[model samples]
Target: MVYRQEIMLTGAGGQGLILASIILADAAVQDDKNVVQTQSYGPEARGGESMAGVILDIDPIYYPRITSPTVLLSMNQQSFNKYIKRAGENCLVIVDSTFVEDVGNQPAYSYPITARTRLELEKEIVANIVALSIVNTMADLVSRQALQESVLKYTPEGSSDLNLQALELGRQLTHSYD
Candidate 1:
């Protein structure tokens, strides 16, 4: 049997959603799964909205876009509002609680990811890494080892440790939600 899953990572520009999507797709490749990754960002580049989509399957994928996601990681209210309604009932919606206030009645795992990245890690730039960790842990979309390797691969040479720490923080955050 063939299985397919779509994942969407959304936030403002400069949040590293595109890099995270690429890393995820690379991990899928390492795991011998077929994956297609795509991204879009607003013109403003910094505060504007950003979205990354990944479609994974055990077989060849005919379509490259994700109309609805099996999982969603929303980092800001705008991205959350834009994509959350399109999510199916079974979607695993993970939101950055600090920036996204209204999650409505939808079953979601909310975490203070940005706050933790800033306060705990003292590196606000690693928030996206934290989100990736949470998504990887909760969705089990790829092997932890593979995801870790991919993280190290995509992260800047001197900053892997911080990103790795953020990843661990993200994993730990999932325990509270579970």
Candidate 2:
């Protein structure tokens, strides 16, 4: 099991990468782990590049930024191109199959995250939560219950069920990664 792990989530500004990172960090914190989260975005709000980094450790965190991530979640082609090359050798590179088509020959997990949300749940905004569920399941970054609780805590009111459904669908999608 990994004691210290670095995770990076990248997408367009409106894709909710920041929220996903927060949820992941919150779950880690709930588990009594030390987690540090940092985010960056381009000048534009919606269409610009967005990135969030989280470092998790059992001991006190000395640094919050991630130079090389062990897990990279790329929600678009641009993010995939920007972060994949810098990922660690065994990095679990996850890409949104619906939006990222240029993953090259990398051994990565590809899923139609937003497509599943739109087609199944009828809402694409919860794609981040879905992606988070996938990450939590595949990487064992956090417990399912903790991740679910963090999702419900961070999710806006009146949409808990929708996000929960998305999270469940994402968990179901984890089989595809194997």
Model 1 stretches astray by more than 4 angstroms: none
Which residue runs does candidate 2 get wrong by more than 4 Å?
none
lDDT against the true structure, each candidate: 0.92, 0.91
- Local error of candidate 1 at residue 125 (angstroms): 0.4
Pairs that collide in candidate 2 are none
Identify the candidate with maximal lDDT.
1
Q: After superposition, how far is residue 90 of candidate 2 from its true place, in Å?
A: 0.7
Error of 2 at 155 (Å): 0.9
